[model samples]
Target: MSLEQDVATARQALEALDRACASVTKHVGETVDARRLRGDLSRVRDDLDLMAGQQSYSAYEPFAGVYGDGDDEGFGGAGRTGR
Candidate 1:
């Protein structure tokens, strides 16, 4: 129900999926489909890592600054201007 709990559940699910993929690859010998599945799994894992990291920040971290203050860039806030 909480963010931490949800993240933990997702991570467990991803780990299980990773193990299953490994087993399939071991038996199937890296076929195209197997490779695709592995790639997708890797991307999903990366996404999960990112989400977990973001969620670990304190609640105020996201809103502590407005207008792209040096302390917080706001994670893709429109206040950012490309050099």
Candidate 2:
């Protein structure tokens, strides 16, 4: 998969883990291991946020609208319909 998809998947998994951790805390009480897990999750989430902040848009959709619609006469039929 693409980097964007991979990151999104990681984020979803992290969120699920976070929720599960909370649920476990309710039953097991606040244990040292649980606290450590929570801290680790927070650090991972921060890393993901930093990665997103530095994401290069050009790396995702390399040619999303580069050719435009083939309705016009411009290169790739882009024309100037909306210009």
Best by TM-score: 1
lDDT of 1 by residue, 3-75 (tens): 7788889989989989988987898896999989987887776677677776322233654455445555466
Backbone clash pairs for candidate 1 read none
Candidate 2 lDDT over 1-83, as tens digits, reads: 88778889999999999998899988878899888988889778777766767644334565558745526465555334554
Off by over 4 Å in 2: 53-83
Reference-based TM-score of each model? 0.55, 0.54
Error of 2 at 35 (Å): 1.2
Alpha carbon lDDT of each predicted model: 0.74, 0.77
* Residue 8, model 1: Cα distance from true site in angstroms: 1.1
75 Cα displacement, candidate 2 (Å): 71
Per-prediction CA RMSD (Å): 9.4, 13.5
